[model samples]
Target: MRTSAREVAVTAELNLSQVRALEVLLEEGHFGRAAQRLHVTPSAMTQSINRLERDLGVRLVNRTRHPVVATPAGQRFMHQAVRALEASRAAVEAARGVGAGLLTIGFIDGYSQAESRLLDRFHSENPDVRAEYRQLHWEDQVAALVDGAVDVSFARPPHSGVDTRLLDTRVVTVEPRVAVLAQHSALAQRESLTLDEIDELEVVTSATAPAEWTRWWVIDPRPSGQAVRYGPAVSTIHEAVASVRTAADSGSGHVLITGESVGQRASNAGVVFVPLVDAEPCRIELCTRRSDHRPAVQMLRALADAACSARAKTGRSVQRGAEPGVGVK
Candidate 1:
C-alpha cells in the first residue's frame, strides 16, 4: 500500500544528548572521561549508555573489555548517529535564521531614546515577540540590516552597501543641525550659529566612520567656498565629547557639527549645543529591510506611523527624538 505524506506517522524523538555521549565515549576511549566530556556523573553516563543500547535492542559496547570497545553493531550505528546529529544541527540553524518571533532593531548613536514610545506600542501589540536593539555607527546600521543582524533600524539613510534597494524607510521626524562647541568659547554665548562660524573652527570628526556620513555630519560643504579644515579623528561619540572638553579647556576651539538631537545626548557641561538654524534638516528615518515581511516589522511600522501622525497634529519639532535623547541604557 502507498502511503501519502499525511498518513506517515513520525515517532517520538531519540535523545540527542545520549547519542552525543556515545559518540564522545567512542572518540575518548574511556567511561570516566566520557562522563567528564558530557558534564554528567559517571553513573548517569552508564545509565544513558545502557538505555541507548537497550532502546536499540542491541549490545553496543563489549563490557568484558577493560577499555570498553564498541561491538560490531555499535560501530555500524556510529556512522548513522553522526549523520543524525549533523541533520539536527542543520535544521536548528536554518530555523534560527528565519527570525520568527525575534524582532531586531539597530539605531544610530542617540535614536534609541527617540523610539521608546513606538517600542512600547510594539510590545503591547506583540507581547510574545522578543525585541532587541543594537546601537551602531551611522554607516554600520544598514549593513547590519542587510546581513540579517537586524530586522529594522532607526538611522540616517543611503548607506554604502545597503541603499534604497536594500531598505525602505518611514520618516519619524526631521530635525535641524547643530554645532557643538566648548561652553567657554565666545560663539557658545550666541543662541544660534551659522555654517560659516562652524567652518572657522577645526572640525573634530570620526576616523573609523564612513566618509560620506562624516562629510554630511560635519557639514563638509561650507557656506564659505574655502576648503574645510579637519581637526582630530575620533572613534566614538564619547571620544568626540572628550576632545571637545580638551579643546574647551585649552581654548583651541574645536567644533563638531552634528544633528540637533545627537548633540543633546552627547553634550556635557563643557559642550554647548547651538542650533545651525540654516543647515539642511536631518531626517530621522525608521529603516527596515525591504525583503522582510514578518509580523513584528509590520507592527513596528504601524506604530511609528501612528506616532508620527499624532505628533504632526501638535505642530511640534521632534523633541528628544520622536518623543525624547536619553536611550534605554
Candidate 2:
C-alpha cells in the first residue's frame, strides 16, 4: 500500500519525551541509570526505548553489551535528536512570558551569604519569577548542570579538567582556606597554620568527589615534599564535621580543610577553625552550562556580576581605611 508523504511524516513523528529518553539512555549507557536520571523506572526506560524503536521501525540499542550502546542507526538519529531538543528548549524559553515559569538554582556549602544576597536581588528584580533552590554536593555539582536538572549554580570552580570544560563561571569571591579541627585538638589553639605544618595530620576527604578536588583541598603533596595523611572519607560537610569531632574526642588528630566562609558558619561546638595562611584561596563562582542561553540564566549571571562588583568595591573601601596612614578624607 502506498502512503502519502503527510501520512508518513505523521507516522514517524517522535515526541519530546521519547527523544529525551533516547538521549539520556545513550549518554548513560545503562537502562537503570538512564531511568534514574529521567526519574523513571528501569521498566519504563525499556518501554520508552521499545516504543521509539517501534515508531521509527529500527533497532536503536544493542542490548548485548555490558554497557548498552546505540546501533549505527541510533547514533545517526541521535545527532538530530540533540539538535531537536536544543531547539525545543530555545523555543520554550522564547515562548515563556516574562516573570513566568520556574527557575531552579543550585548551590553548594560555604556560599550562603553570597546565595542570599544574590537571591534578594533576584527577588527584587524578578518578583514574579518563581525560584527553587537545591543544595548540591561536590561530586554531582557539574553533573546536575549537565543533566538539565538546574538552571544555574553557586559553586567553586571544578577541579576536574573535564568539568572545567563543561561550565562557564563568573568569579564572585576569593575566600581564604581554613583548617577545621576538633576543639580539643592541639591545632585548635593555634592562631594560624601553614600547609606544611598540617601535612602530617590526617585530612578528611570525600568518598565520591573528584580526586582532583579532594587532592587540591587537602593539599595532597606538602610544600615540604611530604605526602599528606588521609583520614575518613565523607560524602557531605556535616559528615566531615562529625568525623573531625569524633576523631578529636578520640585523640585521632583528624582535620577538615575548607573555605573560611564555611568555618565561620559552622555552628558545631566540637570544631574550631584556624586559618591556612600559606595555602591558595578558594574562588567561589556563579556557574552555568556554556550552551544555556535562556533569559532567566542570563538575568542570574548579570545579577551575580553586579552583586560581586558591589562587594568588591566595599571591600576595597574598607581595606583603604584600614591601611596605615590612610583614612576617609
- Give lDDT: candidate 1, residue 156: 66
TM-scores for the candidates: 0.64, 0.70
Give the alpha carbon lDDT tens digit for every residue of 152-182 in model 1.
Answer: 8887633533234446677676667777888
What local lDDT does model 2 show for residue 233? 89
Clashes of each: 1, 0
Q: Which clashing pairs does model 2 show?
A: none
Error of 2 at 62 (Å): 15
Candidate 2 lDDT by residue in tens digits, 152-234: 77766443422244466776666778899898887789999988878778898988775666777887666788877888888
